[model samples]
Target: MRKPTSEKNQSEIAYEVLRQKLLNREFAPGARIRYGPLGDEIGMSATPVREAIGRLASEGLIELVPQLGAVVKRPTLRDTTELYEMREAIEPYAAAKASQLISARQLKSLQSTIDTMKKLHDAMTAGKKQGQDIAVRFDKSDLKFHQTIMNAVNNQRMLTVIGDFHLLTEIIGAARHSYSIEVLEMTIADHTAIFEGLTSRDPEMTRKAMTVHIQNSRELTLSRLQDECPQ
Candidate 1:
């Protein structure tokens, strides 16, 4: 029992470590994930690393190619559009429900995430460059802000589906490199509006705010992708 538990723990560690690397764009889209070297870097054995890779593959974060091992999946424009569409369908409803059901404590936590994001956005604007770590944190806080709302919905399935879409968005966003400061500021404003709606416990306002935010995100993502590869 102890040995199996230890191996499971090791695998979980490897999974989280590798997941963070992928999320941070350390392993860029379509980059091959070599188990041996990655295991070495993460100070784990190949077995656990392989286990971790399999888990990520199951999550659609990595794809296993025949005779090519595993590579980070590169999200296409269609993929982005579909994901945003799903978010548009589901998240506004979730946000509206959250506005009705979220507790004061949860609202405080959500506000904290927004505050952190605002500081990060301000720092990036001042520095004229968003460092990789700051950018990663900003992404996390952004996710947390939304996750907080979804979690408030208390539906496991909704959380799972939305979480998957969020992960895919992160992967695609990483491939686009860092977001512009203007985009970050716009995100902050959108979040503020959402927060205000939640605070007022106005379901319609919350729903509308979430809708606009997701739509803006979809447009921004499409614009960036087009800019990156103009035909």
Candidate 2:
């Protein structure tokens, strides 16, 4: 399906808007989300709001808490482990296959996004943004990097099944402990390696690079959590 220029109804617009905010950390994990209140927040009514929340809930972004209505989901460490495990199995394959099948046009599109990432990184460095906020700015690029790899592979089944994991990883990135400046720099390095692998279109190297990327990020995330919760 093609991206739409305009929403056909209020619910469609509402879902996209809310989903973006959720993904971007406008709504934090365990955030209490009231349907009627959300409608007011988004300048809509309960009906459309309910529909939007339902759509997100289906995607594991929010969960119905019985007595508490819909709450933004907080993933466990196990959730992160399981999620990265799946990405390990699928994303590397996606990257490998994409390397084999990625057309010149697809590579061009990816390079374009890579250029955007360069600009985004420059803006961050110029502004000297600090702390958790850095992740907020670059997390979109992180999502783009992964999504572009999937697009390059051009596999529909990979897109459909791995797509959820793509979003889940973003949530993990956003909702997990904020990365230190060191972690952020390390992330950029890992992404560069993944891009190089894809550009070379080497299946084995690409899979190894992506798996290493996931493991490093996972360890960094868990390390941050350990410092915070001490569990």
Write down the lDDT of every candidate, Cα atoms only: 0.87, 0.74
Taking all chains together, the TM-score of candidate 2 against the true structure is 0.83
After TM-score superposition, the amount by which residue 51's alpha carbon in candidate 1 deviates from its true location, in angstroms, is: 2.8
Q: Which pairs clash inside model 1?
A: none
lDDT of 2 by residue, 7-115 (tens): 2377887888887886678877778888787778877777877888888899887898989988887777777777878888888778877778777776776666666
Estimate the lDDT of model 1. 0.87
Could you list the CA RMSD of all candidates, in the order they appear? Answer: 2.3, 4.1
What tens digits encode model 1's per-residue C-alpha lDDT throughout 19-103? 7787677888889999999889978788999999999999889999999999998777777788899999999999999999999
Best by TM-score: 1
Q: What TM-score does candidate 1 reach? A: 0.90
Q: Give the 10-residue window scoring lowest on summed lDDT in candidate 2.
A: 222-231
Off by over 4 Å in 2: 1-8, 112-127, 227-231
